[model samples]
Target: MDFDHIAEKKQEQKATVWLNLWSNRSPELLSMQLAKKHRPGETVSACLWKSGAFNICYRVRYKDGPDVILRFAALGRAILRREKVQNEVPEVFGSGICWAGPYIVMSFLEGMPLSQLLKDPSREGRPVLNPQISNRSLKRAYREMAMLILELSKHEFNSIGALEENKRGIFIARRPLTFNMNELMVSANLPEKQRDSVSSEEDCRKKFTARCLFLNITKELCAEHSQGPFRLYCDDFRPSNVLIDLSTSRVSGVIDWEFTYAAPAEFTYVAPWWLLLQSPEDWESDLNQFLIRYFPRLRTFLEVLCNYENKLIEQQLLSESQRLSPRMEHSMETGLFWVCLAARYSSMFDEIYWTFIDSQYYGTFTSLDDRIQLLDQEQQHEMNELVKLKTDQSTEGKESFTDHYPIDKLLEL
Candidate 1:
């Protein structure tokens, strides 16, 4: 991706009113646009998180009293508009969902991003932390995060006027299709040997067939098993979207709920952990600590919460399986259908794929060789079997997967 170009596009696409609104309007004038009352001469100081992709956030402060964070929608206007019309924004904000939005104005939260503490040694972006902070401090941060996740899981909302109530709302809950590991392999821009092995003609056919089946199964399941009375929120839950106080090491508040959806509770439980770009190791380590220290009294509560989420997932799957057209159910149970669908949705696939394969960002689970070995035994086997069922008996097509650009090229962005 062209970072400069993308950044330029982002700036251009950001709502003009948002970019200039605060700059042009003094605090007195801007206060008129806000529903909340403010005192005279309140100064608004704005600082943007340049690394964010979906929303533009500004930190606003008053000479007296507290600070507030204002977030404006950055991309996908239709989705944003729908969220606004449905009143999903207020619901999500009230429920404390993270990382979903069009625009939100909230109280400015104190403390720093965890990235400040865990700066990458190879990168010069952020300053490194003092080693003396101790392992206990790190664990405390993670434990706090876990408690926040647990807390958010309990809040829920119903779909009152979502864009596609039947298809998109939480009331009509369905398991989101799983991430496609193959596309991830392709997008990682790996070596030719690795790419060639995974993108064979047989692999594509299997993926396509499997995707067809999964959708069918999912449709059937929704028809049969979807229960009424569900809650949903902007589903993007990540640490960057949270604010934490260094002194307290507790989550001050959760921010960003633009993509919030009303669905089965499981959707919220798993959404926070899907950023293939972030290392699971770091998350597990950090969150484990946060959970331990922050919610020491609530350890038993975690299991009950997880069980509730699992129950929803189980019901959704069972209902979908029972209603599935033979073809659909077959595809879903096998995992081929979801992978192929991911390939067709190239943009989504690419974003998620990059997350999994971008070892620099997310760090590999093991060596490349080890990952490939596992892939062959697991992912490759599933894809191969599906392809055999979907394609011509005589000829198997083969293609190499290579990154469109190298790491150096990506860094230049």
Candidate 2:
């Protein structure tokens, strides 16, 4: 599809909105003037907040009226369709959280983003770091997010058949796809001659082979258990997606479910760490604290949760086993195969990095020797240093508090 055309259309729409909004007066002074119009009894003043990247948000309030937020969807029909699909997904509305379609209109959540909170060094502005965040305030936030995901998982769609029948296909599709690095070698605006130094097709093929090998290895490791299927929200699920009340560093609501799906249970379990951009250092710094705070008595709770998740997967798999096809089998082996296929074809490297890595790790690496050798001495040295750092960290003494969740539990099985 003509993504450039789509992007250009979106830009035109954005420009039109900007023109209309600023046609008569200075936009800068508008919000302040509007807020001044608020009367003593007014709950809020109607004003636009231009913080979101994709949507325009307006905060509206009136005397004795609850403050409300209205978001205007900015993208074209495709985005609207995706939003509609997301809205149809039961868990979002089932959580007793009301959102008005894809263009969200809801009561204004009264808190700052976690990003803002972290910027504040003071305890009042930061999240309360404790053994257990019993502050009734924090509980609501965390519980609400967790509950939303739980409810989403409870509502299943048969588009891909039951879990057992489509386990391999689901697993394969779930594996992240990577973008073609070769396209990035040439700037879109650059002259053809200027990009002559770009590698040959053979060279590109080698790199692809190496990546496939990595994916193969990862797949082998992930599929060893053959448990069952569950659901996943493959996109961001970080603290930034949550709103925590300022008075209590607790989560008030969960936002963003654009990438939700039903997949392997393992995918969901590792989501928290994955979203945090898991690294050895991150694990060391927050694993214990997270477990202690979020899953107190981690062993029992983790076991129960894992068991429940696994059971669901098994149930889904069994239900769909009879209709499994060879192509589907290959897809299942790869996890979210169709999605991965689309990502691979998109040619957008940034979008497909994870998926590419997954597939590359699983495919082949024999052709990568040349590319591997081509790496500059400094890059090789850096890789060595990273390996050493990881090895040393793992060998070091264990912390008094450690995550009860197993490493395998974090994989997208």
Candidate 3:
């Protein structure tokens, strides 16, 4: 079986394990957990709200008050709480570990996901823009989104890492947690740092090497400000996480800050890759076709973003020195947007690099071997072992799949 197929199956199995475990115990245990915050016999009902790759959300309703969202983290014990961006972000009510897992209780923003307004999920493959949505509505949506990004970029940290809270206070201590890092860890089945496993560490190193090398090159070539004053960036900040008021075409709230962290300022300079509701590397259509559909929307978004940038500057809410529009514009023009995208998404890195980034930066390569010399000897050996390990894992996964669901059982189904 293909490595991607096996990796995907492994992910599905993990999610199933989590869901089954949660379902079996959550009704009783979850009620007990929520009981701490609310009054007894308040008549609360909870139902699954949204399930992503690494977390699950439930909408908890009460007979007397407004609804709140309960999110269970499948990977880490972290939560996002920023008073500065409180208007746009969720306000955490409480968080703790229970029998099920680590969960966060927060205010539920009212409105549908922006993705619902922009595209039809009923479509089979890559989602296209909704024909019913007017250009004016899209522009209005972009304007609101522009303001949110600008506001988020206002907060800065000295170190590039995730914001975590301890007894002392909040600090940037942990390695920056991105969605790709979590996904890679899952796919590789890497264990906790306490576990003594050389292969696991090798797999982790393989993932980081690409990012480290890319950043070093980018710092020298494009992002001179990559070293300091890192800004908050949400890996999951897309239409799916953005809530919108349909009637007014306004952004109601931004949810899913779990994958956010203090990242290099260059990351915040790229125009959002979600403008088309489909990622460039994952687009099913030809590259030209995707770009044709993409550029127009990109232009619309940038125009609205520029207008917001000017408004914020004029109001003294933003300064000319802190203006993000020009940097973002330059990123797109210089192909730095694609570079940043490739560097960030591990699964999409190969496709994005070969298609748009590699040749432009490093010239054409006949094969990966041709470029392997760019890395140190130690890294080159590690990469070879990682590939062998991946191949073995794929084989083992295929055998395990067959053992669990044999050919006869599959035929019977």
Candidate 4:
């Protein structure tokens, strides 16, 4: 259930024309139901629009009434969760929870797309942020975004999971998340010859042991934070997810509430990836140049967050180390965000765990792989011994277990 496979499989199953609303081929039953919910007495006109991979959005217009957006579950309902605050999200008019998945029609909010506002056009179509976003009216957008993070942090949960509800009550999900990592390797459509290239059962166990130890700190940190006081967090919390009212520099809408979860509050304690508007490693511009451009806006965001941190401290919800007054002032200092990144996106175990975590600890590298220049004989010998010892100790393991992780250490974050 790694994030990539979920999307990949959905893409694979896109043979039905009606499944793709953006093709302007609307499904009749869906169109009628959506029209009935929001436009009871008029002819329905469903105009298709492209949206996230999980949904097919239709602008359901009436001959004589206001239009609404219909979000059909073109992929699956893995991302859907009932909202805690209805006003913070688009208003739902109709919903379907069926065997196929689910769909919802909701009131459409009008505003400029924040992506068009924040992004500078670049070659290859990837968004490079505009130079001026560091200042002027756009700074207000980042500040408001910082404030939104604080607003979301106001919620507290007893555990980490997707938030869900039923007639019984609201609860933390006992089921695995859509980003569950164990299923990633299992689901990959690797060639059989490549699969057969795996060394042996012992080698596989040893590699797993070494990787677990290498990732021990991150896994433990995640476990510790999962205990309580989790706040609402969206994995895709970039500016593109927002809609802005530029005249007043206010956030008019926070759309796409998918992937929202009650996650660790420490996920908010660090400076966010949103300021850069892209992952550091994959920025459209030169990484250094992107930072040079992104730093001022990042500073603005952290400063506003610091003000909220003080407020949280006064309210007894935050402590000194958790405050961001001074630490996040350099490139290497973004280790906390990388730690949070590593913990949350297990699909990125190699990229985050090996590279970002290592970079955070050992500083940047000329190359991140042992592919060309293999490890020295002495280093290889020591690593092999370490993995063998760890493998023996882990022989009685329950898959993905972390019962021994201490919860109190999370406060030190």
In terms of lDDT, the best-performing candidate is 3
Model 4 over residues 1-413: C-alpha lDDT tens digits?
02334333432443242345324543645655655765475756666654664466767776776777766654322222222122123557757543234567777777776777778765345455676555655656666676677667667778776666669876775532333221232233221111221234455433443354445455554564656677777766778778888787678888876556776666766667767566544653334465576667777776776777788789897777555445445423646666765565444544555545654444454543432123456555665675455445335333332321121221111
Model 3 off-target regions past 4 Å?
Answer: 1-4, 26-29, 32-35, 38-41, 74-89, 121-127, 165-170, 191-216, 246-248, 285-288, 364-413
Lowest summed lDDT across 10 adjacent residues in model 2 is found at 177-186
Error of 3 at 327 (Å): 1.7
Better of 1 and 3 by TM-score: 3
Candidate 4 TM-score, C-alpha based:
0.66
lDDT at position 254, candidate 3:
84
Better of 2 and 4 by TM-score: 4
- How much does candidate 3 score in TM-score? 0.77
Candidate 3's residue-wise lDDT over 1-413, tens digit each? 00244444555665566567667875544743574464333646778776664456777777776677776664221122121122123577776556555566777788888777778556765456775678998887777778888888998888887776669976786676676665554443333221112234444344445454565568776546756788889887877778887777677888877677888788898878888887554675456567777788888888998888888889888888787778877877777887888778665664565577666766776655555557788776777776665545434524454222222221221
lDDT by candidate, in order shown: 0.39, 0.38, 0.64, 0.54
Rank by lDDT (best first): 3, 4, 1, 2
Model 3 residue 303 lDDT score: 90
Candidate 2 to truth, TM: 0.43
lDDT of 1 by residue, 195-279 (tens): 2222446345433433443344444544431463444434445555666777776666665554454544323322233222142
Model 1 TM-score is 0.45
TM-score (all chains, Cα) for each model: 0.45, 0.43, 0.77, 0.66
What tens-digit string does per-residue lDDT give for candidate 2 at 1-413?
Answer: 11232233433554464446443554334432333333233444557763443444567665676555544443321232223233322121111111112344445567666544333244452233332333443333444444445544444333321122243443222222111111121122111112121134443334344344434444564473235544444344555556777776566765544334454434443323322222222233333354343333232233434444455558773223222223233443444442343233333322233333433433442444544564557655665554444344334442321322122221110
